[model samples]
Target: MQEYTQEQINQAESRGIEISTDVKEQLFEYANLIGEKEKVRALVRNLADAVSQADSEGVEDLLDDARMDIQELPDPTIGKLELRDYGYMEEDMVPLRKEAALDYHRMGSKIYRLGSAGSKGEYASKEMIQAHDGLFGMESQMWERIKDNNLDYAEENLGAFQEPMSVIEQEEALKLYDAGADIYLITNFSSPMYVTERMEIERGPEHYQMSMTELERFRNLEWEMQKYPQIQSLKEANLLLGTRRTFGIYQIRDD
Candidate 1:
């Protein structure tokens, strides 16, 4: 009979799965009865089923079984590529998640720019001005470091801006996009009309106070900035400012 490592047993138990002596014996007997290739196929199928079903207990049970079988098998190798092919790895999802996050940030910056544009020479709430100052200061510091080819240090200071959207937010954003709502006006900025439209679509109001047309302008400028590599470089480094306020920083690529 094969013995499972303590870690394997603990992992199963942590997911509220019980691996009784009977289950252990059954696994060992099955392994002994099957060819190695058949055993690998069976285990892979079981793992896929567990993942598709979102069954944590089933996953833990299968992992424990695989660990025990691997200990006894002469050829106990599984390649990273194989695991990825089996949908057990999420390495490919990282870039998609980052892109989604950047899209969300761009929308927020559009709203902010739109609201600020209409208020030229008008007194902004002290609180709003203070928030802008804080953001501007941080961007300036980051730009200085980036200009010096010290992106590693600049990245370290960008923790606040790098926050990714939660799963719920991502789903909500997709739903709005699918419903024919403008991406720029989805959750980023707020105006009375935009707020009404957003609440109708999302069943809630976002606190941003920006207009849709101005946000459209912000989006246009952002796209235009990409045509000039030097301008793009300045924008990426947070050194570029809009006619009214600082154009928001571009997303940092992990290259």
Candidate 2:
């Protein structure tokens, strides 16, 4: 960044794009994080080096062995952040009880800096490994904060969730379903006479807790959520049935 003149930075800002000071500092942290990833990579290579020396048939070429060793790194958790994954924003997302939300956001921010667990590079390479390390470091720091707080921070910020599942809790039940008190049941009754009509009770496969009506409402809300461009990953989908069935099982598709 220092290589770019202040004028260039100003021009970049004027063009409606620029990394903020916060971002710049984060990038520096990213660089340090990636460096740690490299160290792990090098250690793995060294292990392979020792093995190659013992076995005559092992890795005929030292350089090739080292390169391949680094390329095929063991799987490690990495974070990936898309532009729209606003797990940290204030006004845009469903409320996630403040405590949990803040914890998640802080962790998310840490993960975001390292290209999210080096997920930025799909194909593993030296540079990719470093990027992965950077992300790992950032996430480590975030989780570390959680432990450091003794959970004092997390407990203080929790608030009622505004997601579809949370909304489902507010629905009304029409039958003596086995679902917990939280799940609400609502039927599109053409008349009061249809109340007794058999509706399959769906409380996730094993847990027969969510009434059919509650499930149906969740499915409807989920379908509406899909219209959002940012909700690409199912992870971001708000209407989840904990260990229950997929959201679709609740709906009766019309031909």
Candidate 3:
């Protein structure tokens, strides 16, 4: 039997095969996310030279911090943050328990970018899912990664964009859900609004006067630099995750 030729691949794509295993594999490896360890490491090693040169320029940590600051959640592999506080509040209610607050964060965000039909919204329009075959094997790969991290329910076409959860907690959350619990999906990369978590305690009463905009470095970074180098590199030289949505789960369920 003949292997699928490049022409066959192109034809399949045009007719809406919608994905190339090669591309997905590349993305998988590129994300440093999941799959065979050797392949993932190989992808990193391929980019290692370029990554090193980028690092050597003395701008590594800046980029790394930028990633940390932007990512909705953090990863176990990436280490811990200097400060983090996830909370939930009603119109006039005091904050709830930390776990509850975290759940609110998770559930609320997932409700926003819900892609109708089995986690297919993120990659394309609603029509695409209706027209195409399964998410290929993409969703499986996505869910597997989330499962490894202990996340639940998402068909996971791509991966998670952790803006806040530590990788450890994420793994635990997945495990908790898999042990038999319903779950929800949150699109970290595209949220309607970013919940600004203020560390009121860290600054003390005096610092209360300052808004997020008052913080110079953060202000400069957020407003002025859309693609500044300060947000482009990493310091530890370990690894960077692929999609931040690896933590996502189902958007809604029926009884």
**In angstroms, how far off is 8's CA in candidate 1?**
24
Per-residue lDDT tens digits for candidate 1, residues 14-107, read 7665555654554454443332345544664565456557787997888677667544321233322232333333321111122222332333
Off by over 4 Å in 3: 1-43, 51-55, 58-70, 74-255
Best-first order by lDDT = 1, 2, 3
lDDT of 2 by residue, 1-255 (tens): 222223333444564554346433433333222223444334334434444355424423533453453333211111112212323322111212223323333222212222322233221222233343232222343343333433212222223223342222211332323222233223211111111111212211111223345466545545765677655433335334234443533455899
lDDT of 3: 0.28
Give the candidate number with the greatest TM-score: 2
lDDT of 3 by residue, 1-255 (tens): 012223333444464444335443433322332222343334334333334454433333433443343342322121111111111111112212233223333433211112113232233222332344321112333323333544333434224432332122233223323322122233333311222222211111111111222223222433433454444422111112221223423256687
TM-score for each predicted model, relative to the true structure: 0.17, 0.18, 0.17
CA lDDT scores, all candidates in order: 0.37, 0.32, 0.28
lDDT of 2: 0.32
As for candidate 1, its clashing pairs are: 190-208, 190-210
